[model samples]
Target: MSEARLPTLFIPHGGGPCFFMEPPRGMPDPWKSLGDHLRGIGATIGQQPRAVLVVSGHWEESQPTVTAAAAPPLIYDYYGFPPHTYQLRYPAPGAPRLAAEIRLRLDQAGIPSTGDDIRGFDHGVFIPFLLIYPDANIPIVQLSLLASLDPAAHLAVGRALQPLRDEGVLIVGSGLSFHNLRGFFTEDPRIAADAESFDQWLTQAVTDPDPARREAALTAWAMAPGARTSHPREEHLLPLMVAAGAAGEDAGTLTYRDHIFGKAVSSYRFG
Candidate 1:
């Protein structure tokens, strides 16, 4: 039997450790629907990957980096959560061999990268996996975004790792479509409008049938409608670039779309 080519995913990880806990006061659990969607992701893809390479928005380095630990720990990486959340764990084992392979691929592409055995799984990786693969059984290797936040550069990094897809490695970019911290808890109606404008543009760009046009649109994403209003800082949005690059000529599909914390959020799958 031939190895199945794994699809690249861009997932929205909701606020903090709250996904594993109850909502604040009367607020509906913002992560409930999103979590449900993510839990079904493995089935949607039709097979379990040998390993998962996660590009988390939470971790950034001057250069690309991969976690090299054999048994990675959990990073709470959130603030003011309830006591139980602080103790929440997703004990997924690390894939050091896979990390080494990532380092090799990045180096071959002339994208500088390092391996860190000390790095742990940040909420960006653990939270989503805790829902999607609660057994914490799949081997995972976390990749870091570059501090430069250049869309083209991140895309190049993804392209460098494209071969991994056929080798049964699922590349997942974890981030939020609209990540303005200032408007996080606010009930202002304008927030939804701003998020929708950006989300719509992104939807069209990623799902564009023409590969050239799709790449071009993503390269100039800041020019999209309400781009700046949706992402005051573009770190959270950069992961999608990596996911798209690895997508190569594969078409993108909007897998999940919903309103979270008063903003429009979406998830995408490529090839």
Candidate 2:
């Protein structure tokens, strides 16, 4: 019997190293519940994947690229936190063979991708994975977003890699749904309304039954309510396009939702 296909995921990786540190006095622990949700992701999927393909908001390249290291390094991509955060480790093995296969698939799809044996796992990949797979046993390969940040192009890339799901690779897009850095640290009453507006629109778009309509909605996501307010630059939002593309005819489910720092954040699964 064939193995069951894996679902694609769009996960909101919380702010840097927040998962590893205690929330300062009087501050709500933004990552605590989200971290718990991530820890329970495997149960939702029903099985352990052979490997994970992560498309992180942190890594952007001129062209699509995959990490090809045999033993990938950890990248402490964030600053201004406790010193110990810089020394944290995940130590998951690298999926070089899977990376090569992904590059080949992208090339066949006319996407043209490169491989980097030296690339490391940035916080976007590690922060969530630390909670989801604390043992660090599963191999992981990281994919970089195109520097152009074109939604259509990334969607096509995801379409090209959809076959990996059938081959036991879990594809994950690691990014925050509401990613305005300046807004996250402040308390603004309008933030709730803006985040809810955008989140509601996003929930509708991703869950639309018709694939054509879903693609259309995502392609024009900038026109959605509070779209620009939720995402000053769309890099953080682009990952959803990829996850949706890979989803193909599958329907999306809102797997998790929370109010973090007074702004709404969510996660979705497609299968």
Which pairs of residues clash in candidate 2, taking residues 3 or more apart in a chain or in different chains?
A: none
- TM-score for each of the candidates: 0.97, 0.97
Give the C-alpha miss distance for residue 132 in model 2, angstroms.
0.5
Q: For model 1, how does the per-residue alpha-carbon lDDT over 23-109 read when each residue is reduced to its tens digit?
A: 679978778999899889988877888899999999999999899999999988999877898888888899999999999999999
Badly placed stretches (over 4 Å) of model 1 are 24-27
List lDDT for all candidates, in order. 0.90, 0.91
Error of 2 at 22 (Å): 0.7
For model 2, state the Cα shift of residue 135 in Å: 0.8
Model 2: per-residue Cα lDDT at residue 151: 87
lDDT of candidate 2 over 157-213, digit per residue (tens): 989999999999999999989998888877887876888899999999988999889
